[model samples]
Target: MYDTLKDTYQLFEEIGRGRFGTILRAFCPVSAESVAVKIIDKSLLTDETDRACLEKEPKIMTLLSPHPNILKIHNVFETEDSMAMVLELCEPETLYDKIAHRPLPEPEAAGLMKQLLGAIAHCHRMGVVHRDLKPENVLFDSRNNLKLADFGSAEWSGEGGSMEGVVGTPYYVAPEVLMGRLYNEKVDVWSAGVMLYIMLGGIPPFYGETATEIFEAVLRGNLRFPPKVFRGVSPAAKDLLRKMMCRDVSRRLSAEQALRHPWILSGGEANPMD
Candidate 1:
């Protein structure tokens, strides 16, 4: 099976590795283009539920295909030994890399958030929820535009527009999720809020020495912005953050609502110095 794929694509150069498998930057001779191949070992699929989840990924990708901010899958191939998914090649760095040291300016952060919201909004529009929406899962292109990747944890909204389960990274999980409450696409909204906070403050709104402490803070969701840190930030930017991080599910802004926020509408362009 690997040989068959080799006939079409020249797989080389390891780019990323994870528990199940590794990602390699490969080239297609026929298309004369470069692509990323996520090869997962079939042996890891021994668990019935695990195999089901992996199978669901291709379906979810098809549901949101061609969206500007969602990563695109060119093809999927399952072989006797492994599963290969061919995806568009995004630039190497991610949001996690860009703001690793300090937060970006309000205007800059808004610009990026707008793109992020747009992507998630598209997914929600299609009734899909990206269970894991963290900076590490978001990749940027050469142009710095954001692309939401890794639908591995994604699931359909299902009946009633909500889902049940405890999934997602600790820091970004919605408070409701932490409470073991039912959730929907709005969970992604919470993640975007956490991301917005990190972008502007250079740290997550809820943080603790351990994952449990972090979970406790998220459940509390009693977050605040220190004036000294946000001193020069614009009012509209702060307002949007407040709206986004609202703990109440009903009060929290949806992806579409977030996009319409004044700060986002302004393109996050008003420099703080003004």
Candidate 2:
């Protein structure tokens, strides 16, 4: 058991909170470095299952520590009252917030996609699958550099790892996972495709008033690309999207292959935000 801090970490404010807990900005006393502290309430973790999941996050963070594009976890400590995780502090908003403000320019969107793919590829190489890959989970540093965060739903695929449990945001989940089919790293690639589509087209490819309708559309595997909205979107771009979002996991392009697609390689002047 860990002792509770007499007072909250100074020099920051409470920025966000969710069902799990709250996130606050704090300065490291030793390095004077700024970071985000995720505080998980011990009281909320009433079962062994919840405790196991909480403990797994730190282990996964350690495995992913070396990746440049992934968020860096500096420390994990348990107080009598809460479990605190110190993470590198990101900037004012997430990718989701940025898109909500305005659609991304073509170059900017492509650049972000490239960065995210680099991160995902690194995780795959390490035998970890980020079950949840969505715009909301991607954050930006003060320099506007992208960092992948939120590994609460992540799982390892290496020897002795379990793949059970239905997880991931509906908008970005691959068909295989939705259908209860066994899946692998390709699921991340599918979610990446959905994210890229939203970045380029200004809205998700599939949206419905209800969750059932959205899942039905996803299962159908027909993602419409409106040329008018996605004006100047290259054929290569469309092709890559189709390959990544394929219903059949085996048919989808791997993250590495998608990174090298002609559309991604070709530098064009078209800006989606224009």
Best by lDDT: 1
Q: Which regions of candidate 1 deviate over 4 angstroms?
A: 271-274
Which residue ranges in model 2 land beyond 4 Å of their true spot?
A: 1-11, 46-49, 79-81, 160-162, 267-274
Least accurate 10 contiguous residues by lDDT in model 1: 265-274
User: Candidate 1, residues 4-91: lDDT per residue as tens digits?
Assistant: 7787899999999866899999999899989999999979776776787888898899879998888889888888778988988889
Model 2, residue 88: distance off in Å is 0.2
* lDDT (10s digit) by residue, model 2, range 1-274: 2233214345368887967798888876667678888889978987776787788888898888967789999878786667888888998688998887556766777788888988998888888999899999999988888999998888887674336556888788887787876678888999999998888788888887787887777888788988788776766667778998988777888888877866565532442322
- Local distance difference test, per candidate? 0.86, 0.80
Candidate no. 2 TM-score: 0.90
What is the lDDT, from 0 to 100, of the residue 149 in candidate 1? 94
Per-model TM values vs. the true structure: 0.95, 0.90
